[model samples]
Structure formats: C-alpha cells, structure tokens
Target: MTTYHFVGIKGTGMSPLAQILHDMNYNVQGSDIKQHIFTQQALEERNIAISSFDKENIKADQVIIAGNAFPDEHKEIVRAKELGLPIYRYHHFLGEFVKKFTSVAVTGSHGKTSTTGLLAHVLEAANPTSYLIGDGSGKGMENSEYFVFEACEYRRHFLSYEPSYAIMTNVDFDHPDYFKDVNDVFDAFQSMALQVQKGIIACGDDPYLHQMQAKVPMLFYGMNDNNDFQAGNIQVSPEGTTFDVFVRNSFYETFSIPGFGKHNVLNALAVIALCHYEQVEVSIIQQQLKSFKGVKRRFSEKVVGRQVLIDDYAHHPTEIKATIESAKQKYPDKEVVAIFQPHTFTRTQTFLNEFADSLSQADAVYLCDIFGSARENAGDLRIENLQERIQNSHIISEDTIDCLTGHGNSVLLFMGAGDIQKYQKAYESQLAS
Candidate 1:
C-alpha cells in the first residue's frame, strides 16, 4: 500500500484533503504543530495519526504533500527532498487527483466553501460523490461519479485545476498581500476560466465576473434578468431564504435554503444551474438544498442564554457586510454586535476604510488586534485606525467581556479568517465562569 504523508495537516484545506485521501483507502498520516484546531477533530475521528512536525516522519517510500503555508526550507520538506520522495503542493496534487472523476471546482472570493458544500450535498443524493470543502470537511467514495471541491483564488493557486465544470460565485478584491488590485485578481480568474472543460456557471452580478471570457460555454446565474439562470421573487425570514429560479425567463423551480443573506441565495442558484445543466433531477436538488446545514464557520450559530453567537469566516469587507446583513435578517429586533479581528496586515492596510464602512452596519462593534502573518511586516497599521471610523465601536480585550455581557437579547457575531476564535473562546469561558 502506498503511504501518504502531509506536512501542516491541521490547516483548513490540508485537513480536508487528508480526510478525502484516508477515506479513499489510502494509508495516510500527517505532521503539524500540536496547537489544537477545529479541523483536527475530523482527522482524529478517522484515527489518522497526527504528530508534531519532525523530519523523522518522512520516509523514502511515501509521497509527501506540503501545505502552501510551509516554505521549501521547512525541516520535513528538507528531509523529503533528501530522500527524493515524490513531493507535491496541496493544490497541485488536488489538480491532478481531480482528473479521476467528473470534477466541479467552485471558485470565488467568497462563498466557495458554502457553494461547494451545497453542490456536493445535492449531487451525493443523486449519485456517489466525493467532496472537499474549505471548512475542513471531506468525503470520498471509491466509485464516485462526481467530485465537488472549493477552489480558492488566493495567490492564483486555483489556476492549477482543470475541472470539468466550474462555478464562480463572484469576483471581489481580496488577498491584498498577493494581488495588486481587483484587475490583477480578475486576470487570475480569467486564466482559470479558460481551463474549464465543459462550462462555467458564474454570478452575473459581479462586474469583474461579468467581464469573464472563457473558451467553454459560460452560463450566468444571478438576480439579473439577463443571466442564463435568474433568481426572482426572493423571500428571506428567520427560518431561511426562498427564491424562484427562472431559466431564461421561464420558471424552472422554487428552491429554499436554510441560510440567510442574498449571497446564499446566489450560491444555491449556482448549484441549481450546474446540476440542472448536468441533467440531475430537480427533486434531488430541492431536497439537498433544504437539508444542507451549511459549512462550518460560515454563519455557524449557537444560543447562549438570551444572546445568539454567530461564528463566520468573513475576513473581507464584502463578506463582513453580508454576515452583518444575515444577522440583522435573522434577529431583526435584537442589537447586532460585530466582533471582528482583521486577518492580515496587508489586507487591513489595503481595505481599512472599506472595513470600517462595512463593520459600521452592526449596531455595535468590537475590534481586536490585527492577526499578523510571519511573512509580512506590520508597519504602522493598527486596529485603532478602523475604530475611529465607526460610530459605536471600541477595541476589544479581556476587559471587554463586561461590556459585551451588558448587551442582552443581542446577536454577537464573531467574524474573521484568522485566530479570532481564541477571542470568542475566551469570551465564552468568561461567561462560563
């Protein structure tokens, strides 16, 4: 049996890829920092051995998969190189592996995970399907006919994939550390669009995506009437959101998803458009959309006492605004409080004003220290700069628990793509004490 070893397996994308490999009956083991991460839970449940990073874990016979975050000088990577083991980066391996099945790569700035998860769920109901979500969830079947996965645009890594069909949710300016501007980001997506084998289902609402030119057939899905797949007569409630799908002005079907915000409605439309194009039964699509519980950390909610706490991976300004809007829709009568920890110094510096404008949508806001990356210099950017632009905003610390607890009957939204959960965990622990 071929053994597969992973470096930095606890990462959100790495963990899911490891799980998928394990489920496919491969002998898989990995090494990462001992720090606890939510992504490790599924790995542990599968009994896949995870150990602290060590060069001794590398074997000449095993293939090594390295996480993108790790440098070529990493100890395990050095050892693997010494042994001349077959080494592949995460995205490169996924790109090659996905060729085994009819793959659907869901790509965009936001909603990639949710859309991939939804499409996976819907397709699995009809046929054997393998899926990898960015939220650290994956499943594999030996005879899967369809493989659905999230394709991130960061650093142009998604350009590695050549999928059968592609669903692009939207194109937004994000990952400021790498790309120069929105046009730079669009060029990457345009390059990726050309690689799709069958067709592309894109959100027509985004001006950037609207300008996409693909060699394959490109189908547009959005609220706009000009789209190939249009969503109309939308209704949003605390329970969920429902919309009618129209295919080029003809009513197709009415679908509902157990999620809030117009973004989610657009996500489902992308899934519906692709599945319908593939000739999947409409009944299966409707049933799967109704049952999807949503991907982890994308509007994940829990009730503690009279307050609702939502944890979401909304690091970008556009995503932050959608999260705040979702909170308001679900709990219209309660105060919506946003607790955001800006992810990277470059991103924070680049979208400083935009972040302030979006975060101000909440009734109250708490800003935490910017989550710094080892690769970037912090310079002079500070959380204080963002707080100054918002009305009811304050810096959050261990001392802010008292102020947070004062907001009764409120929705507390913990939003970010960094280690913001530590702050949420700290607040939860204080409440317990």
Candidate 2:
C-alpha cells in the first residue's frame, strides 16, 4: 500500500484531505504540532497517527502532502525534497484524487462549506456520496457515485480543480492576503468557471458572478425572478427556514432546512437545484435538508444556563452580517452579543468599515486582539481602532470577562476564522465559575 504523509496535518483542509485519503485505503498518516485542534479528534477517530513535524518524520517511500498554510521550508517538507520522494500540494493531490468519482466542487467567497454540506447530505440520501468540507470534515463512501467538496478561492487554489460540475455560491472580495481587489477575486472565479468540465450552477444574486463568462452550460439560482432557479415565499423561524423552489417558471419543490438565515436558504436552494439537475428524488433531498444537523462552527449552538452561545466561522464582513442576521431570526426577543476576533491585519484593514457596520447589528459587541498571520507584521492597525468606529464595542480579554458576564438572556456569538475559541473557552469557564 502506498503511504501518504501530510505536513501540517492539523490544518483544516489538510486534515480533511488526509482523512479522505486514509478512507481510500491509502496508508495515510501525518505530523503537526501537538495542538488540540478540532481536526485532531477526526484524525484520532480514524486511527491516523500524528507526530511532531520533524525531519525524522519524512520517510523515503512515503508521498508527502504539503499543507498550503505551510511553506516549502517546513522541516518535513525540506526532508521530503532532500529524499526526492514524490510530493504534492494539498489542492493538487485533492484535485487528482476526486477525479475518479463524479465530483461537485462548491466554490465562492462565502457559504461554500454549508452549501457543500447540504449538497452532501442530499446526495447521500439519494445515493452514496463522498464529501470533503472546509469544517475539517471528510467522508469517503465505499462506492459513492457522487463526490461533493468545498472549493475555495484563496490564492486561486481552487483553480487546480476541474470538477465535473461546479457550484459558484457567489464571488466577493476576500483573502486580502491574496487577491488585490474584488475584480481580482472575480477574475479567479472566472478562470475556475472556464475550467468546469460539465455544468455550472451559479448564484444569480451576486453582482460579481453575474459578470463572469463560462464555457459550460450555466444554471443560475437565486431569489431573483430572472434566474433559472428561484426561491420564493421564504420563511425564517427559530426552528429553521422554508422556501419554495421554482425552476423555469414552475414550482419544482418546497424545501426546508434547519438553518437560520436567508444565506442558508440560498445554500439549500443551490443544493436543490443541483439535485434537480441530477434527477435526485425531491422527497429524499427534502428529508435530508430537514434532518441536517449542520457542520461544526457554522452557527453551532450550545446552551449554558439560559443563554445560548453560538460559535461561527464568520471572519469576513459579509459573513458576519449573515451570522448576526440569522441570530436575529432565531432569537428575536433575546439580546445578541458579538465577540469578534479579527482574523488578519490585511483582511481587517480591507474590510474595517464593513466589519464595524456588521457588528453594530448586534445588541452588544466585543473585540479581541487581532489574530495576525504568521507572515504578517503587527502594523499600526489595532482592534481598538475598530472599537472607535463601532460605538459600544469594547476590547475584551479574560481579565475583562466580568464586564460582560452574568448575561443570562444574551445570545453570545463567538465569531472569527482564527483561534477565537480560546476566548470562548475562557468566557465559558468564567460563566461556569
């Protein structure tokens, strides 16, 4: 059996891909700093060995899979080069791996994870389906006919994938570390659009995506009447969301998903559109959407005392706005509090005003120190500067947890793309104490 070793295996994408390869019967193992990441549990559950990232970990016969977050200078990466063993970048390996099955690559600036998850759930109900989600989740079926995966636009990494069918969730300016502007982001998506081998399912609501040109047959889905697939009579409640799906001026199906926002409703709509195209049973898709429990950290909820704590991976301004709006729909009577940890200096600077505007939607706002990228320097930009723009927002730490403590009715939302969980853990421990 060929062995695969992943460098920086704890990374979100790397870990899931590792699991996918392992389930494919490849002798898969990896190395990372012994951090207690959520991905670690998945690795442990699969019996994938995790070791320290050392030169010693690199073996002559093992193929090395390098995490994008890690540079070529990483010890194991260097060792792999010295040994001249075959190595593949995460996306390169992933792109090649999924080609064996009928693949659906869900790509966009936002909602890819949730959309992929929903699509996977639907496909699994209709037939065996394999999927890799951004939330560090992956499953490979013994004989899955369909493969559903989240395709990211960061660094144009998704360009490596030429999926049979591609779902464009909506393109927006994000990953300040890479793309220069919204147009630059759109250019990347357009490139990906041209690479789709079969068909394209795109969101009509996004202005940027509307500008794209694709060679494949494009099916547009959104709330707009002009789209090929439209969502109508949408209803949002604490329990979930329901909407009627219209295709080519006819009511195709009435669907409901146990997720809170219009964004989620849109995500469900995309899945339904794809299922219709695939001729998946509408009843099976509806049942799967209704029974979906959701992925980790995409508005995941935990109740402590009477207060509900929601954990979300909403780092960008648009995403934060969606999460807050979803919270409002779910708990209209409760005070919503947002605890945001800005992910990167470049991103924070790029969307500073938008971030302030989104957080202001909440009843209370708290900011943690900006989570700097290992590649970035701590510039003059500070979270306090963001607080200046956001009235009633305060910089918070474990030392100041008492200031916001004892809120039994407030919905505490922990939001970011970084290690914001540290702050959540501290606050939860304080509340427990």
- Top model by lDDT, which number? 1
**Model 2: per-residue Cα lDDT over 1-433, one tens digit each:** 6689999888888888888878878798999887689987898999999998789988878999998888888888888999999999999998998888889999999999888888898898888888999899988876879999998898889989989999999888998888898899888999999999989999998888777798888898999988999999988766788888889889888888888888998888888888889999888988999999999889999988778988999999999999999988999888999999999999999888999999999999999999999999877998888999999788998678767665668789999998999888887888778
Instruction: Return the clash pairs for model 1, or none.
Output: none
Q: In candidate 1, how many Å is residue 202 off?
A: 0.4
Off by over 4 Å in 1: none
- Deviating ranges (above 4 Å) for candidate 2: none
TM-scores, all models, native as reference = 0.98, 0.98
lDDT of 1 by residue, 1-433 (tens): 7799999999888999999999999999999998899999999999999999999999878999999999999999999999999999999999999999999999998899989999998999999999999999999899999999999998899999999999998888888889998889999999999999999999999999999999999999999989999999999877899999999999999998888888989999999999999999999999999999988998888899999988999999999999998888888999999999999999999999999999989999999999999899998878898889888789988656567898999999999988888888888988898
**Model 1 residue 241 lDDT score:** 93
lDDT score for residue 333 of model 2: 84
Measured on C-alpha atoms, candidate 1 has an lDDT of 0.92
Clashing pairs in 2: none
